[model samples]
Every structure is written in structure tokens, then in C-alpha cells.
Target chain A: MTTTTIPTLPAGRTIKLGLSRIRYEVKTYFRQGDAVFFSFLFPLVMLTIFSVAFSEQSFGSEAAPLSAAAFYLPGMLAAGLLLSGLQNLSIDIAGEKGDGTLKRFAGTPLPVLSYFIGKIGQVFATGILQAAMLLFVAGVVFQVELPSEPAKWATFAWVFLLGVSTSAILGIALSGLPRTGKSATAVIIPIALVLQFISGVYLGFSLLPEWLQNVASVFPLKWMAQGMRAVFLPEDFASLEQGGTWDLPGVLVVTAIWLVVGLAATRMTFRWIRKDS
Target chain B: MTTTEPVVSVRNLHKRYGSFTALDGVSFDIHRGETFALLGPNGAGKSTTIEILEGYRDRTSGEASVLGVDPGTGGLAWKARLGIVLQSTGESGNVTVREQLTHFAGFYPNPRDVDEVIAAVGLQDKQKTLIRKLSGGQRRRVDVALGIIGRPELLFLDEPTTGFDPEARRQFWQLIDSLKQDGTTILLTTHYLDEAAQLGDRAGVIAGGRLIDIGAIDEIGGAEARVPIVRWKQDGERKSVRTSEPGLVVAKIVAQLGEPEALEIIRPSLEDIYLQLVADHAAAEAADLMENAS
Candidate 1:
């Protein structure tokens, strides 16, 4: 063993823990092939399934063939983001927190705030990859044409970003809900399925019962999906419904509410380790 | 006891969990550069005290200072000076030994060089190997390396050598000694008495949320917890006596028995002292139980 004179160091500096945490997150996220394959890839596969299933169906002459497919494309994309963003995020974060990684970080000079920042960064970066993959497969295999207008693309970008961001916050908040990893899976898996079904990923919100639609709209998922359908489909496709236009303001409001709720949940929920909790 | 400032000082610390007293009026002092071992059995409030010191748990009442600042409110400056080696690592990862060390080093302002720390822990051969591939002992070395890489002035080691082989344990002792030589103060808690004896300048024994004994390693058990026990055969019958002066007792026994056969004078080890202390606490509790029953 070599003992060299360690140059004197000051202890007050902030540890750039975010970089390490982000690296760990990205690396570990890729290593979980089951989550990557099922959570991210399965949604792209779902896009094909949706496009093919809805390609020939006509919505009582108001909607043309493949028009319903276009409307649900963005919803499926939002679902893909949420699968990893909310479902996988909650499960993985809860698991890590349960396993003492968070506690170890608490002891270091590494700031916890940085970890949140890094998590957001990694999730968004991975979401872009998911978006790219979804767009590619949708264009090629599914014969689903993306919106070519700049205004619609702008709307799609805003809603998609807002959707994933809100979902990520919700993920962090949900992490504190389960004391153990297994319990987290039990809590999050059903919630993910419910979000997919009720939020218009598998079908339009109009197809669900009025009471369930009202209840689902109270959450961001429904508004986020509706907003995406508005963006990626024809301009008057929303008017083809009972409402002439999708509730743009509602998506903005619900996503904002989810963001605040997610942040508050994360702040309030302590990790598995507590001094006397 | 030369008027030197204590490195760690706690006064009247009280912690309670809904009616159960985890620590009650606990107080002690550890001087600079001294190894003060908090010795206790499971559920004896040792963890509570250590957690309070480590700034991981809050105290219900009273003042506690580690390196002259209360850990409960201590900020980054206070935390950076301290290094803690937890009982276990979090996960087995594919990150190489050097990679993990370097990653941990990034968290501190002034960390030891990555290669040097890996070498210091005697993992040169395994430096490039993934952490998951290493043996348990090698992984433990990585934990220690991360703890000391920041060149912390005060280190908290909790049962650090629990899973180490004998040779690795001895090497760990040498590393600790070298740290002491460099003027680092360590607060260690271990169940191993020999480790306490070999490393601690003073040992503090805690039982039932109370510090029952605290003194030099040699003085804790002898003449305090238990008298030295002398054993030998006396005319085909084995006899034992507890005495303050074990050497004198041995001399007398040798004279009477003409070089006593199977004779042995045994001083109380940290384990013996620990057991007696716990048993005494249990006996007191039993007496209290009987009194309350009546």
C-alpha cells in the first residue's frame, strides 16, 4: 500500500452528485431489459396495433379511415412516456431508496436536489429516444403520417413535454408511497394499467362511461392524451366530437396541477430511511 | 487529561420513541486523535447514539457536538470532514473498482487520487474488475476506500471488519493506525472486543440506554465490571477466585501447589466485560420486575 501526502482539501464544496446519479440511472435503466422492452418498446408496438386496428374503422362518417389512428398515435406516444416515466420511474426509484442508495447519498456532500435534476434530465433524454423510435415505426410500419404543419407540431411538442414532465414528477412522488419494492410494484402496476385504459391510450375518452371519463379527466393523463390527439390529427377532428375543439386549456391546467402535486409529494415523502418515522 | 479540547462532546442527550427511552441523559467526551469505541450489544441504544452523532437521527433533547458542531444541524462543512463506512454496500454493479472509487471521489472537494486509493486498499490486481465480480472481502475494501478517499478528519466506522479474513483484518488495523498517525480521529463501534482493545484509546460500554462504563481499554473490566479470575486445580478439585491482584493470586497458588498444574490467570476481555455489564443490567431488570409484581 502506498501512502502519499494528500493535498489539503476544503470540505465546503458541493459534490456534483447529479452527474454520477444520472449515469447510474441511465445505465441501470438500460440494463433492465424487461422494463425497456415492455415499457418503452411495447408502446411502439402498441402504436402499430392501434394503427392497424383503427385503419379501416369509420367514426359514423364524421371521421375518415386512418383518421382515428392518427388521433390515438400521440396518445400512445404519451403512454409510452408514462410507462417509463411514471410506472418504471416509481418502481425503480422506490427500489433504490429501499436498498439504501439514497441513504448513502444523504451522508455524502452530494446534494439531494441535484439528484432530482439528474432524474429529470435522464428521463427527458430517454423520452426523446422513445419519441424518435415511436415516430420512426409509426411512419414506416404503421402508415401513420405525422402532422406536417408547424403549429400542430408545436402543440404536440408542448403537450408531450408537459406530459412526460408531469409523469416524472408523479413518479418521484409515487416512490415514497411504497415502503418496500414489492409493494411499489403492486401499487404502480395497476395504476399504470388504469392510466393507459382510462386516458384514451387504448380507446378514445368518449368510449368510456361518462362518470369514469369525468374521473379520469380530473387527472393529467386524460387531458394529456386528448391534447396529443388534437395535435397529431386533423385540425377539425376534435370538432367531430360533441365538443368542437379539444380542451387545450384543460390539458395545460391539469398538467400544471400534476406537476405541483408531484413536487409536493416528493418534498413530503421521506425515503425508506427515517430517523424516527 | 491535559486540558486538551475534546474532538467529540455530548451533553444530556435524550431520545424517546413514544414512551420507550432509546437514550436517556447520555453524555461523554472523546479527545482529539483518540479512538473512542462505543461498545454495546444489539438494541442497547448504541445505534441511537451513533446515529445522533452521524447526523442521521435527531435527538429529542440535549446538545451533541461532533468536531465541535452539533450534528443535528451541522451543514456541508461539518459533514465533509467526516467519513462513514456503513455496514454494507448498496448493490453489486458492473462499474470497475477504480471507476466507482473515482465516482465517489467526485463527491468530495479534495479526494485522494483514484489509483492511490485502490492501491491503498490492496485492490491493485482487481482495480479494473467490475465491483460485482469481486469477492465480499474485496468489495468491503472498496467501501473502506470510498470512506477514506476524501481524506476526512473524522471517520465513523461501524463494524468495518465484520466479514474480513484475518489477514485483511490485520491490514485494516494497520490502515487505521496510519490514519491515526496522520491526526485523524475515529469513532468506531464494533462487537469485537479484540478490535476494541487493539484500536481504541478509550472504550465506552453502553447498556440499556445508559453508558455504564467508559475508560482505558485495559481498565474497563479489571477492578470494575469484574475482578480478574484465577483458576487452578487444588488437590484434584478445581478452584477459582476473583481478585483485584491476579499476579499476586497466581504467585500464592504456585507456591501452595508447587508450580500449579493447569493453572491460569485470566483478565476480563472486552467480551467478558460486555457480557457482565449486560447480565448485570438484566439482573437489575429482573429485580425490578419482581418488585413491581408484588
Candidate 2:
């Protein structure tokens, strides 16, 4: 007869499982050409086009001026973060749900937390790499100066982490909206595009109308872009920002709030299986 | 491998979706190392019962102990001892067969060898191929490989061979036979009576959210259902009669006809009993509905 006994797993096995999940996620992300294009290459191409088209322009006044390429670099970073954490992650999860992949995992011994950890880890790592590649290309090819000081790098780190976390969490929450893999793109792409435009990734925040700026400020993507600018741009260049200065505290608070809200919403709404499935 | 302690014991299990009752006080037990087949038609609450036992769904009110632990509160330790192959899982499409099996193995305390599992599922040649690229039958084998990879003591297979060719189905049966030989208790739900007859030592017929009948495969519908039918030619007219003792009936017919030609004795197959049970349950449900309407 088959004996029934609960066997205690060795210590640190959950960690091992999480690490292996991360490895699998990373491998799958790289293997899919469309995912790589959107997360990494697409942003670089956008940067190249923007730099070549508007290199001669200046964003702020003469005293603390910034090249268009330098000003656009931080926006590119924000764009990459949104692509990895929001667009790609949501579609991937929606596809998984539609195909019953998440349900399969839910039935297994693997903890649900481990699956989220793996997904978040994959997006975080890829988001960072995409940011690094964008920064490298902007510095080398476009002659854009990145954040050099330790404090600036620290600000960049927290902002990037919070931005990615908020986006990934919201992505997971929104993944529950699409009933099938085919509908995921239809649901997510328009939202992502609108968010990208309003958050000043495609156009400078200063160029947008005051009413548009007010609407954009309610979202984490705008705060993420502002925080990136605070790191990469000169202090006096804050003249170009709303209220005539970079509100560093406001950026932190908004991103943190979104992170908490997104986490809670995802915990409530995320579905492992599609309804019709 | 027989034991008095049933590996799975369920009693008064009830599952409801608002006013709709999926399972109404349905109950059964599966002994250790025994193959128990739950035969049911579509929408018969088979999946709900199985999912509840797998700890994937909440029951309205019931007592279900899988492997000595209440499945409602079964923890990860309890889950590790169970393997569940869902109806249709196409989620691991991006990963190769071998990669998927290797990853799932990490979740278990004592996983089978990855290569051995692949070979056992007859997917050794396709192990390196991505799941999406493999044929439907091959992908089902991958599901089975992952299901058995954990070396689960009690395996739950939900309509496992829904879309397999005859040859593939036979091959899959052989794979299940090997797992049975290893003393893994199996609880499976399938519409195929042949599959139930071939794999199940004991079988249950479920219809209209109730387990109406359950017993050994050969005697599922009771002694009356097991009665054999005797047929013979008499004066160029064909006649048949069902009797508990076919020998006596055949002897009587032979004596009356001088010699019985084209004589045949046919016992009720499992399929016959199953169909009768389902039909009876449907008729009872319709009658109940009519009485309530009045």
C-alpha cells in the first residue's frame, strides 16, 4: 500500500524553487524574439530616431540648458520600464491564464508566491538591462550625459524599482480582464499607448497642456519619468518642470502609493484561470 | 498493496454555485493502490469533485480526507504527495518537453528521473522539442510525464485521453499500467467505458450530480444488471431472454426446440450498465422536476 506521510522539505528549497522559476522566466523572455524587440530593441530604436531628429534643440533656458537627447534619455528609460513591467508582463500572464498554465501551477506543490516572485524578478532584471542598454547607447552614440554622482544613482535606483513594481503589479491585475490570449493585446495596447503619451514619454511634459499634465500626474509613469529627470538633468533645469522645481518628495510618495495600491488590487483580482477555460 | 485504510475518503460532499448544485452530498472512497474510475457524462460534477480533492476548489460542505489530510486545508506538504493532470493544459508551450519536466521535478521531495519519465511517456525522441511543436498526443504525454514526475502516491487524472487516436490511447494505457504496477493509487474520470473497464478495478457511475452506483467493474449495476441474455433460433424465429442462470435458460430452450441453433449467451458489459444507470437517473430527475412543478 502507498503510505501517506507529510515529508518535510529541506531548508531553502523554496528559495531554490524561486530561483529556478526566475531562470525559466528569463530564458523564455530571451527566446521569444517579439518580447526582446519590445523590451530592449524597440526603446533603443526610438532613442536613435529622437536623438537624430532633435539633437540641435534645447529643453530649458541658456543658464541650465539640456539637449533634447539628454532630456529624452530618461523618458526612454521610463518607456522601457513600462514595456517590460506592464505590456509584456500583462500579455504573458493573460496568455498563460487563457491557456491554463497558471491553473496548472496552482494545482502543484509550488507556492503561488513563488510564481509571482519569478515573474517580478524576470521583469525587474530585464527592465534594468533594457535601461542599461538605453543609457549606454545614449551616452556613446547620442553624447547624452547620464547621472554620475552617487546620490543621483541612488534616486534612480529607488524610482526604477518602484516604477517597475507598480507597473508589474498593475499588469498582473489587468491580466484578469482579458478572457483570452487574443483579447489581451486588444485590452492592453491602447491603455499602454495612452499612458505612454500622457505620462510624457513620447512628448516633453512642458510641451503638454496644463490640463493634460494634471491628468498625467495621477499615474506612476509620470512620476517615474520625473524622478528619472531629477537624476539625469541639472538642478536648475527644474525650471522646465511643473511648479518650477522637481518635487522629489511628491515623486516618491506617488510611486509608493501606486505600488501599494497595485499590490493590493493584484492580490484581489488576479485570476490563474480564464473564465471560459 | 491492499489496505483497509482508504487513500481517499469523501463523505457528504456538497458543491453549489449560488442556486445551482454541482455536487449534492456525493461520496466515495479509493483504497491505496487501487484504480478507481469515476464514470460520468459532461456537466456531471466529476471535475468539481476531483478539483475539490486536489485542493483547487472550495466545497460548500463536506468531509474529504485525501491521504489522511483534509483536502480543504491540505498544505504544500500534503500537495506534494498528489499528482493532478488537468483536462487540457497547454500552458508550457514555450518550453521543451524535457525542460518542463525538469522544472516540475523541483517541486517534489522525491521526483522521478526526468529522462526516465520522458521515456516512460514514450516522448524520449520529442523531449528536446518545444511543447507547442509536438503533436497533440505528444503534448498529452508531456502532461502525464509532469503528473507522474513527482512520484505522487495518489494521482488524479481528469479525462486524460480526450483527444487521442486509438493507437495513442492504447499506448497511454500501457503507461498508466506501469504507474499502477508501481502501486500509485489512481483516481480518474473519463467518458470512455472501455478506458474505465481496462484501467479501473472499481468503477462508479455519476449522473445529475450524484454517485448513483459504484462497485467492482464486473458487477457495477448489481446482480440483476449482471444477468446474462440467452439467444437461440426457434422455427426460424430469433428469440432472446435475460436470466440470472443462462445455463438453465439455454437448456430449457434446447429441450423445447430439440436442438438450439445460433445459440449465444451475452453478459451485460460495463457500458450497458453505465448507460442504464445514467438513463434511470435522468428519468428520476425529470420526474422530480415535474412533481415540483405541480
In model 1, what lDDT does residue B233 have? 86
> In candidate 1, how many clashes are counted?
1
Worst 10 residues of 2 chain A by lDDT: A268-277
lDDT of each: 0.79, 0.86
lDDT of 1 by residue, B252-288 (tens): 8777768886888787777888788778878998999
Stretches of candidate 2 exceeding 4 Å from the true structure? A1-5, A55-67, A147-151, A179-181, A268-277, B1-3, B232-237, B243-264, B287-294
Count of clashing residue pairs in every prediction: 1, 0
Tens-place lDDT per residue, model 2, A1-277, is: 4665577777777778888999999988898888788665887888889888887888767876777788788888888888899888888899888778888887678877778888888998898888888888889877877767899999899889888888888777778777788798888888888988998898888899999999999988898899988898888868888898889899989988988888888888775542321
C-alpha lDDT (0 to 100) for residue B179 of candidate 2: 91
List of chain B TM-scores, one per candidate: 0.91, 0.92
Task: Estimate the TM-score for candidate 2.
Answer: 0.91
- DockQ list for all candidates: 0.28, 0.47
TM-score (chain A only) for the predictions, listed in order: 0.87, 0.92
Indicate the residue-level lDDT of B207 in model 2: 81
